[model samples]
Target chain A: MVTPLEIIRKKRAEAVNRIVSKGYLSTIRVYVGMATCEIAAGSKEVMEVFRQAIANGLTDVYLSQKGCAGRCNLEPTVEVIEEGKIPVKYGRVTPEKAREIVERHLKKGEVITEWAI
Target chain B: MEDVQYKMMLCDGVSCIHNQSKELQSAIESELDKSGIRDAVSIHLSGCLGMCNKGPILIVNPGYTIYGGVGSEDVPEIVQSHLVEGKPVARLVIEEDHLYNRFFRIFGDVDFFGKQMRITLRNCGVIDPENIDDYLSVRGYEALAKVLCDMTPEQVVAEVKKSGLRGRGGAGFPTGLKWGFTAAQKADEKYVICNADEGDPGAFMDRSAIEGDPHTVIEGIIIGGYAVGATKGIVYIRAEYPLAIKRLEKAIEDAREHGFLGKDILGTDFSFDVEIRLGAGAFVCGEETALIHSIEGARGMPRPRPPYPSVSGLFGKPTLINNVETWANIPVIILDGGEWLSSIGTETSKGTKVFALAGKVHNTGLVEVPMGTTLREIVYDIGGGIPNGKKFKAVQTGGPSGGCLPEEYLDTQIDYESLAKAGSIMGSGGMIVIDEESCMVSLARFFIEFTQDESCGKCTPCREGTKRMLEILTRIVEGKGKAGDIEKLERLGSMIKKSSLCGLGQSAPNPVLSTIKNFREEYEEHIEQKKCRAGQCVALLSYVVNDECVGCGACKRICPTGAIEGTRKEKHLILDEKCIRCGQCYDVCKFEAINKV
Candidate 1:
């Protein structure tokens, strides 16, 4: 029988491997601050915008919700991190701005300096 | 795996769920279907972020843009503008102020999390709490595995002892010593209990901890059971916390399936199983002995402790009981060496404390600060000071059993010894900030009322003594106080403190005693002058027509009693005999005519 230690080790290894193999380093990553406060601030709608963009054939962009980014007033926050690049955060996001981000920033490979927090 | 182009994550925390995050998820799914690219994106749910005030947050990758307060109605617009156009939404972006932007420049963006050190709350908002895989990725059960494989039970006990970890549940008893006593006992069966009966008003630390990371608490309890040679573990939580209980139940089920619980756990001779016991919401049940009694299906009254629970507990056998916060610390201490934790806190109290910061404060939420961090930092720097720029009067710590500290104590460091020296015990991290608008006498009366109602009536000193004290406090606040009422309260409060049974009765008078010690002048003013300086006591306030009275008939029309006698557009005279002191005239006076004297 596999020891409980071995079982735990195997599980932990698999979990970590899954996270790594998901292309965090290679893929473009997007993080949403979806703490309860952010969600109340309409981050869910902002995340939906990203989902729609991806469904429209936006590729290699990995999107995930993180806990609060700590700036509560800037809820419904969105962040983008590319390989070997500094992450940029946007605060007080509306659905319209989310769509604009998909067009101007995500597709054109340009940072929206005016919108970035 | 399919070459997924974009990933979107939604919050599955209880708060988001309440905000219809599920509906929002489905709405996005259908929106993707409408675009005929459903397989291009994937959606997943994660745990609560500390920003509970914001909910239903969503994240999209590639640009790492976060959207807050997203509603279902706005879904189609997001899809059309962002997805079809290949442009991330600019309109929906959250914009913070310049100070936060500077912090982003100076410290890489600390924001609301700048002053916080998240040791206990590490995994809370980071992972999908319900998914065991999410927990596993964060090395969730690593500590237990280490304890089972490498360290002996005695070594585990010794490690905890070296950490200088006092119990987070009020009285700062050394946790390791309690475990050692139970371990040394030659009983055939020993039990470990996690106390979740958090009865302090406005406290949600334990509830949030359980909801965000139930597995941690379970892992801690299991490790505790292993270290103390106990085969059974019980989590005694109040039934009021339904969500926490549900999450904890799910976590236990998952752990058992993973072989973290049950016979020969982790392929060792050590076998343990955990069960949940629901408390009936008694404040006294937070006491260890009373908690043990409640677990045993008894009336939940605390007994005298020459035979502490460590020596003689459940079923007449030795038992180890630690509060929810205390147990939450065990796994961390085991994983990170005791020295690592000891280095972070004060010499006497090691590790950070989680406080539910509420009342009259700007940022009212849960905050965890390292031991020896000043109250000033917590109240001003973290809590953003008193709301509306009101002068902070006093802060109440440690629930009703704890004392209230005055403004002078703001610089005082938060720890077991420092707080006690300031005439307050750190009772389970309930920090309520009081403002100048609040009356101190009324505040003391409010706490006494709560404690007196929840006294459990088990002992005389607590039952009768608290009743008498409450009566005196009530009279004083109601403008009927006599000259000797303050002395009567002090005498009764000290007597109850010295003679009560259990912690509930023993410290029941702390609010009265501490308020008297710090704000005696307020009490004297209430009694001697028959006046409430803060104007909080209605009975003591009498509205008088001042020189500015325009006799607009507003006071006359609004007063329930015909207390104001004057013609229109002239100064009104408020009759003292007929005036009920309702303060209707005071509120209705547009001319600043009626003054509450």
Candidate 2:
């Protein structure tokens, strides 16, 4: 019989594997800077923009909120990471740009150079 | 159609809530519904991002764009423009320097976080604190598992001791040694208490730690319990921190469900459980003895030490008490080993310290730096210097119990020994940067007043001494002080420091004493010349109409007291007797006519 300790060890292993595998499986990832400062600076609207885009059938893209990267003045930051590609960080993202990023960048596989910080 | 392609994590920290982040969340939900994409995206709540000033933060995945300062009014535009049209809003994007590129480079090379080394705050702001899975994925509870499975109790204590970890709760006591003392005690029941009663004015390090990553603190506490052979743990936190309390409560519940906190954890016989005890917001209760008293359902008053809490404490049993920050350091020590931590900080003090950077600094937020990092680096490089181009006057450290250091002391490395040698205790890390506009004499008086009011009055020296010092400082600020008032204050301050029963009274006069030592001339000017150069003391200020005044009659018209008497387009003259010294005329003077002397 497996003891409680062994059960927990197994659970931990399973969690690590699940998280690591998820990171690898996703073809493209979108990260929003969702720190308190970023929220105060209007990142929520940006998130909604992305949500709507995804609902419009944006596929193969996994989106999540990450913690503050400490660049507070340029908050509401956004970054797009594609597998085997350099991640692109976009600062001061608004709702309108969120749609453009989804259509122009995520769909066409192009970085929004003018807006990327 | 397919799985949700976008996930947005919204900050649920107290600061964000205060900024109406919940309203923002609902607004986003409604907007998503309007755009008909509610099913394609998901929104999850996360912890603090450390940028409290800019709250209600949101991050979107797959092209990580962090939008800050979001409001409800801006929601529809975001959905219509970005989500529907496939174009991001240009006006709302937070434009930052292109120096930083990584999304989760919390320890990145940016100016605000460049100098910071986040060890105690490792997972803070990064993980969804309420979710145990997020914490577990980041190597949480693994240290506890390692301690319970591989290392014996003695070995655990030895590793902590070897790490050279000291208490982060003001006093730099060895944490491992304290555990050793408790382990040696002969008792059927032993207790370990996490002292979360962080009472320092402007200090929120403990609150943020618990709010951002409660599991880390919980994990540290459990490891501590295993090391000291304690089966019971209590978190004595202040009731003022409702969000922190709620998060900690949830974290405890989650940890228990996951079998990390309950009996026979990880299939070992070392069963440990933790309970939460709320403090009624007493500053003195931060003292270990007083904290234990409060936890025992008694009045929160500190008793004299001899039989320290490690020997006999909490209902006549050996108890181990560590501060919130101290306990938060445990898992890192266990996971990284003592030698690894020992290599980071100064020669004596190992690892990093978290400071609540407030006051005149441009970036007034939480910053953690390795021990021995200079005050200049903290105040300038990391804090972005004093705001509005104001001259850096001084930085106050250690809160009310700590002292204010002058610009000359900027090079002094921040460590236990150096801070104490500078006549300031390394308090629970409340660093307030002072600008040139603030008068040191008034600042000293403000701190002394707080201590005098909070003085438990249990001891005579702290009670009577702080009251008298405050009175003298008050008199000095009001321009009623005599020649010998400063000296009298010094004598009383030192006496109180020596005779106080607890840490409160002993360190109560620290602000006054340190200000006197560094800015003695400010006090001398206040007493002798009856002049406050910073013009902070209203009673000592006298407004005069100077030649620079252009008879604009703006000052005369705007002066509530009608103290200024002048014609249009001419220099104004202030009636000194009628002037209440409100500085209204000075502010209204367009031609720089009003002079404050």
Off by over 4 Å in 1: A1-5, A17-117, B1-111, B545-594
Candidate 2, residue B60: lDDT: 59
Judging by DockQ against the true structure, name the best candidate. Answer: 1
Query: For each candidate, what is the lDDT?
Result: 0.79, 0.79
Give lDDT tens digits, candidate 1, residues B78-152. 777766665777766554221111112211223334456566766665554666776887778988998988899
**TM, every model:** 0.76, 0.79
Q: Determine the iRMS, in angstroms, of model 1.
A: 9.0
Per-residue lDDT over B132-240 for candidate 2, one digit per residue giving the tens place of the 0 to 100 score: 7767767678778777767888998999899888999989998889989999998899999999998888887887778777888898889888877889999999998
Off by over 4 Å in 2: A1-9, A16-117, B1-109
TM-score of chain A of 2: 0.83
